[model samples]
Target: MKKQLGDSNILRNWIKGFEYCEIGFNKPPNSLVYLACTSTGRVSNLRIQNLDFYAPFPNAICSLTELNSLEIYNWTGLHGQIPSCISKLVNLRSLVITKTSISGSLPSFSKNTNLIGITLSNNHLSGTIPPSLSTLPNLHLLDLSSNYLCGEIPKGGNMGQFNAANFANNTCLCGNPLPTCFNSAHTSAPAPAPVSTTMFDSAPVPAPVSITIFESTPAPEMAPDSNSEFLSPRDLDTEILLLQMKKQLGDPGFLGNWVIDAICGFTELEYLEIYHLPGLHGLIPSCISKLVNLQILLITNTSLSGSVPGFSNNTNLNVIFLRNNHLNGTIPPSLSTLPPNLSSLDLSSNYLCGEIPQGGNMWKFNAANFANNACLCGNPLPPCFNLAPAPSP
Candidate 1:
């Protein structure tokens, strides 16, 4: 009296019965294609890529409650919102759906505590990114780039470690690892208290009349305090640096109490390291190149853009790690001429292009140092085709 296929076989049957698209596998025992099941016959992983099919998100896939990883890529015809029922897959860890026509706001995955990575880039997704995403404790890799997401980026948790490229091409999105939000009302902190005009007004004066009429009076100008001390050149420079950072980085909480003297104390700084600071956006401060005594310059995992600063002045520099940033433009040719003291360099994961300069310490590093760039070529990387000799007659 028992059914032919028991409850444990339900996920397997769903996979076989699925006909919305032609599923193919790499070296299939055809029956087990496109999916991997747990010993209990529950589907645990599903990956479908490059299939030409026109269909909405396959909601039936959500029924595989044990599913831990779901990846669908380059399905140009795949459309519709990622079904909310996906949250039902409590074991879901990694969800990647790229190069599709999927459109919708990212759904909340509050129940999926084990979730680690979520990449939904290169799609038609629109709407503000949910702030709750920042609260995911185990979440690390998040790439929502090339979509239409907008609004301020959330601040806490591991969000500060993600690369700027992860959020690139979303024109409307603003805040850390991207540009600062100009709209004051949307900022995370409360707006500054309005200035009191009454404090600047002169005391009310009675006019010479039967009725007590008030007369307009001019406020007296205040004199500068004689006890105020003049700031030295070093102190002034520190203040300027602090203000520049504040203007560019949008005043993160850790920097709220930073005073000019705190930075002035580091006048002889030899190794300056700035990492895991997501709010650290904007160009590499040209003044950094002026640190003649600096032996190491490490600024990684931020949204720093523009060309790499000229480090010719830092003759003592031995290590430079500017990886995982939004830096564009060609590597400074001068870097190849740096003194032999320069032994380590890492400019990977940036938008840098053009040929890798030869000579000097450039020969010391390998391909890994210059990997993941926009159009980098030469020695350490695949040679630039443009540099190839003309095909003879």
Candidate 2:
């Protein structure tokens, strides 16, 4: 590192013939004096990892224009906005910063074309994830866990391969594959109130959640309308749900159990998620199975305690997440018969017991998903296994 007290610009970018440089040491007064002897704007392919450069002058690091790949790691004391100049690193491909205390909204990176991977875990940053970041087609290993990020997860990206743990601990994040926020309008209605089993069993009948959809004739293809905004019918359904939630929350005496109604109201919904309401209890309304359109259902960390409802008959059902609840009873045999399209089925952290369901459509997931449940048993778990009987006794 060099510093110039007088003039140092005439010789910048003339690094003789150095291709890469790494500066991870302190810059004393003498070092600063020498850095001045050298010029700027020529350093490229630099890797200044694990340095106190940010401490002496955080703004100093942003001036480097030749960085093609930057890794600022183990520098926990760095703070403030990543200078907007970061976008100037047009050739930057990999940006990795771990074990830092940096805070602020990540700058918009829509202009970045070559960036392929970003790892910003274990930080103190907060804000909604920019949907633009989701547009990076080459991003493969994004680790933004353990941050203060809140809001609905941006969907419609090709993010199907990432496991749920990649997003674990971000309690506020909602939507597939993340669980829906318990207080979001979709799940804001209080959970079903507890009731005596006899009362439920003696009822004349359970009202099934149902919706009738009339197939309409297809519209003729036309040139794409430039100004037309296409609103999905499902989006309209969610808007109506939010409106109902707002009205209910406004009236103090309004029924607190609105989420149950929300679930019951959207029988035609193809996707459903409810997450993180500690006070929510009682059985999942049996009426949910009546939703023939249901494809993805996630209900996590509620006060719900009951048998996993039978979906044996719902061939359209695919992914189901029911972790961290009071749910107990044997693994449903009907789940084994899920349609071939089914991929993931997580029921971890509950009171569930009995042999793990070993079927064609389900059980493809790893064993960690079924952990913390005391009663579950299968090839992956011992003791719950039936002991081999003595010869033919």
- Candidate number of the best lDDT: 1
**Candidate 2 C-alpha lDDT tens digits along 1-393:** 233211133224435573333232233321211111113535433332333434411454456544434445445555554555667755554565555666665556666554544656665556656777667653433556766666666665435434456555552656656875566532211211100000000001122232221112222345645644576787667656745743533532332322114555666665565556565667887777777777556777788888888886566664577999888877777887875435446789988878777765443344756888856777446545563222210
Taken over the whole model, the C-alpha lDDT of each candidate is 0.62, 0.52
Model 2 compared with the native: what TM-score? 0.40
- Where is model 2 poorest over a 10-residue stretch in terms of lDDT? 194-203
Residue clash pairs of candidate 1: none
Candidate 1 segments exceeding 4 Å error: 1-33, 184-393
Which candidate number maximizes TM-score? Answer: 1
lDDT of 1 by residue, 1-393 (tens): 002112222234344446322233432211122555565766666655554546666678778787766767666666777778877976776677778887767777777665656778788777677777887765645788887777788788757756678888764778887888887233222211100000000111122111000111212354655643687777667667666644444554444543221322344565566665554567776766656766556777787788888887877665587998888888888998987446457899988888889987675456878999888899878889875222211
